[model samples]
Each structure stands twice: as structure tokens, then as C-alpha cells.
Target: MRVMHVLKTVSKAAPTSLHRSASKTSTRGRKSPVQRATAGAITITHADRVVYPGESITKGDVAAYYQRVMTSLLPNVVKRPLSVIRCPEGARNTCFFQKHPMGGLHHVGTIELKEEKGSLATYMYAKNASSILELVQFGAMEFHVWSTRIDRLETTDRVVFDLDPSPRVTWERIVAAARLLKVQLDELELTSFVRTSGGKGLHVVLPVNPACSWDLVKDFSHAIATRMATGQPQEFVDTASKTKRAGKIYVDYLRNTRGATSIANYSLRTRKNAPVATPLRWEELSKIEGGDAFTIRSLPRRLSRLRKDPWENIDSVKQTLSAAMKKLEVGA
Candidate 1:
């Protein structure tokens, strides 16, 4: 049997941890180009099943798409506990969130979580192309990963500015607000990465050193957000109330919590057009009219024509909140 019962041994003294094997053919050191492209490790049970009835995209197609993009997508997810949204029948069928045990799946990475309820739960991780493809076989339609890695649960490596616009806000205004946030981040000398939220907004992320707790990060994020909102009241808000969000975008900094997860880069989203969460250059942000501008149908071509990954240096860059916090003159 290919399915492995991924057991996470946890205790009061130990934080949640998993014994991960990236693939069935696990070996020490780095994986090669050839290893990443192999889909042979994963078995797709419903190869011909149409998962996207309107677009006629089959289960096999989704699996293959994941395989092709797996190499580019792994860094953002590897070692990070994930929240998977599965549509077992199709996009048209009832779907639910899968967060624990991973049921019985092939080559899926596992991690234990310190739940708020004072217990441990086994969550899934994607360690290799085989594992990513395995989830596709299990009907995973969307993947969301914690910003913090499993090895360092208390420390977060990135901060996200989720610019959630109100229903009444125009797309143009949303773009403008995103540009505003980017410029402010730039002024602080922190490199910012902007991406479509795969919904009606944009997310601006900055890679930071994981030397602080979730509470401190959350506080720093709030300071930055409130400062921006205070300065540009017409353009933004710091809360989620629809009434307060009138004609403004809400800067959601709450995703910095201990267990909150965001959609992984290059992951598919729940939408009629099947839009993929895309990384963007600051210049590209101005031209985008909607979040769905780049869908699964178009991203492969975009990746092929690109000279290099826009977020290529993200993981390598070492940044800290101290400078940005000082620049904003805000305290944690």
C-alpha cells in the first residue's frame, strides 16, 4: 500500500512536529531537475474524472499542472503546515476544509499543530512534487500555508498586508490603494512583493527575520496598517466592518496570527475562471484590472515566457521589522 499512516508524536513539552519524507524515493541533500518533473511517484485514481465541468478540466489535468509547477511552488510551502480545500466531486460539488490526519493519502507530508483548544492535530504539508500531485488525486482544489515554518512555529518569516476592498470600491481604486501601500513600504527600505489575493483585492508581503513572536509581529503589522489608514482615511480602513469600509479598502493584518494561513503562491483558487494566486512586480500591479486577470489557463504561458521568477530573491533576502518600525515611528 502506498498510503502511509503519518504519525505525529506530541507531548506537553514538545511543540507539534512531523517526521517528513518528501517522496517515496527519499534521499539526503538537494533534488535534481529530473526528480522534480517526475509525476510517476503519485498515482491519480480518477485520471479521467472532470473536476471542472464548465471548463472540462480533468483530475489528470490538475495533477499534471501541479507537477509542472511543483518545482516553482515548493519553497513557499515546504515545511509549512497547510489548509487544503477539497472539492471531491468537482467545483460544482460540496467542498470542505481538510486540516488533520490527511485521512489516507500517498506521500503527503504531515505536521502536528498546537491547537487553541489545548490539544494537538496532525496537519498535512507538501514536501515534493509527488506530495503535491498526491493531494490533487485526493481532490485538493486550493492550498493555503502558514507563513511560519514548522521548524520555527513561534517565529514568523513574513508579514502580509491583505488589502481587502469593499464591494462598492472600484477595481481602479483597489489598485491605487495597493500602490499606496507599496510606496509606503518602499519608503521604509523594506522590499515589498505584491500579489493578487485571488479574490477582489491584493496582498503585499515583505520577507522578515523570524526572531519575534506572533503577538509582536501582529502588533507591528497593526502599527503599519493603522498609520497608513490614518494618513489615507479616504483610501483605507483598519477594520472589517462593512459600514466602516465604505469606499475604502480594509488592511487585514490579522493573518499574522500563530496559525493563520494564506493561499500559497501559484496555487489555484475557488473562482469561475480558476485563477491562480500570482506574484507580481510593482509595475504590473498598476495594469491589472481584476484579480482574475491571470487564470490557470494563462499562467503556464506567463511562466514559460518569463526570464526569471519575480520573487526569486525572496527567501534569500534578510529583513527585519526594526528598521521599518522605526521608519514608521510605530512601536510594537
Candidate 2:
């Protein structure tokens, strides 16, 4: 099961330095410009409201981060069904995950999807930059997207392995697990990309042709994860059971299933300091210290400094899993 972290209520007495700085810059008579800030066509309200009180990151700051990362962020989320972590009051207060559309947020679009049991369900999706900012305005802090797009709801486009590690696992071991998966994927002729989960793990993504059924994709991912866990019993576990997960990395292939969503790259995590689910070049893995290595404050700077996007060709690489799935099934 996935754990949701709510921002604990911060005491009024302990204010962050960033908050203090904002207070010092306030004009005596006029409203602060930050009270309402624009992103694309949407004006974010309560812009000065601190969402991440520990870091004094306000709703406006979150909007700004989205504005800055929209180019890289949009591709992963646009037109895909979404589930968001909403912290309306702030990161240090109450929050909830919203999968369906809430009333009065017409700016955010919704698509009606048929559920497994035959009932119709409406899920929200971002149409563009403004739609995303509108969601931020609606209190969404983290954006999670489905593997399939709205246009092709039945066919998935990617295989995601969320490498969740037990507390006892070291960073080195986690890196090894990722590289090991890469090698295995290469052997099966599947190209994979790596990213931080923005929490405690890495997401190894395989961009595949949207021709496979969800069951086929899920089973294929499970097979790969199972193969690794069984081959390296001491280092990995394929199951999500916490009892079997101690001191080992859990190859969570569950993200590949229908209705399942993974954190969109560049999305802010609900954790303190607003860590970002950042994409990394395979070679950059050794340099990262942890999953939360890139936070909102640091990500824009990192992007500005990078010569090229780490997952530059992700949208273009539509490799199918047919060959790899067959290879794995045959134990080749």
C-alpha cells in the first residue's frame, strides 16, 4: 500500500526564515503582489499562503515551480488521468488525495471512464498549462498520472517499476538494484529510463508502444520483477508485503496495472521541502544521494544548468514489449 504523508500542523510561533523575509518586504498600505500571481492564464489565489511551512513555500511558490517546469512536466501529465495530493490549508495542515473531479472547479476538465464493474466514473485531467495551474489553485501539490492517456484508456504506454526500498537498505544497494534492472531490461531489448520517486525510491520506466493490454503489461513487469527477486533473494523482493521487504528493495510492478498512477516527473512530493520526482540520466545515478535529492528550490537551477534533458527522447521511443515479454516468458 502507498503511504500518504500529511503536512503536520506547524505552530504559529515558529515561522520559517522565508516567511520572515516576506514580512520584512511588505509595504505598509498595499496588498502584496504575491497574494495573487499569474501562471499562464490562471491567477493563483492565496499566493502567500505557505504550503510548505517548514520551507516557507507558499501556494504561489508552488505555482511558480509549475510554471518553470511546465515544459518538462506537461508531457508526462497532459491528457492523462490524474490523482492529486491536495493540501489546501498548507503542507503542514490537512491534505487528501483527489482522484475524481470536485464541484466548482470547471477550469479543470474531467473525462468519464468506465470502471471494471461496468459503472461510469469521471476522472480529472489537465488540458494545458493553465489547467494545471488551476489545479494548483485548487490545492494540488503532487500530480500522479496514469500510464495510459485519455485517448487510449485501454492501452498503456509505459511500464513502471517503483523500486521501493526498506529502511534497512543502503543508497548504494538501491543504486545497484536500479543498474541491475537496467542490465536485465537491456538483455530483453527494452530501453528504460530512471527517475526519483521524490520520496524513498526510484522509478524505472520503460516507454513502450501503446499496443499491449494492461494485463499483458502488468504481467510482463511482474515477470521481470519476479525474475530479479528470485535470482537475488538477499537483495530484492517482488511482493509488496512489508514482512518480506526488510533489508531488500521491493520491485513494485503494481504501477503498471490499469487505474494505477505514477508520480509525474517534475511533480512536487507532499513531503517537507517539496521534493521533486526528477528524471536522471543513467550516468547521473551515482551522483544523486537520495530520492529527495532534488527539491523545488534546487530543481529549476539544476534544469537551467543542464545542457540537455535526461529523458530527451522519452516521447519518441515507443518500443513495444512483445519481443521482451516473449523473451522473459521463455526464460531466455
Backbone clash pairs for candidate 2 read 51-91
lDDT minimum window of 10 residues, candidate 1: 11-20
Write down the TM-score of every candidate: 0.84, 0.90
Candidate 2: tens digits of C-alpha lDDT, residues 1-332: 23456332111111111121232344576545456666666667778898787898888888878888888888788899998898889867777777887766756778888877898888889888777878888899999999989999999999999999999888888889999999999998889999999998899999989887999898899998999999999999999899999889999999998888999999999887789999999999999999999999999999989999999998898888778878887883
The TM-score of predicted model 1 comes to: 0.84
Model 1 lDDT tens row, 159-208: 88898988888889888888877777778887889888778888889888
Cα deviation of 21 in candidate 2 (Å)? Answer: 18
Off by over 4 Å in 1: 1-38, 329-332
The lDDT of each candidate is: 0.76, 0.85
Lowest summed-lDDT stretch of 10 residues in model 2? 9-18
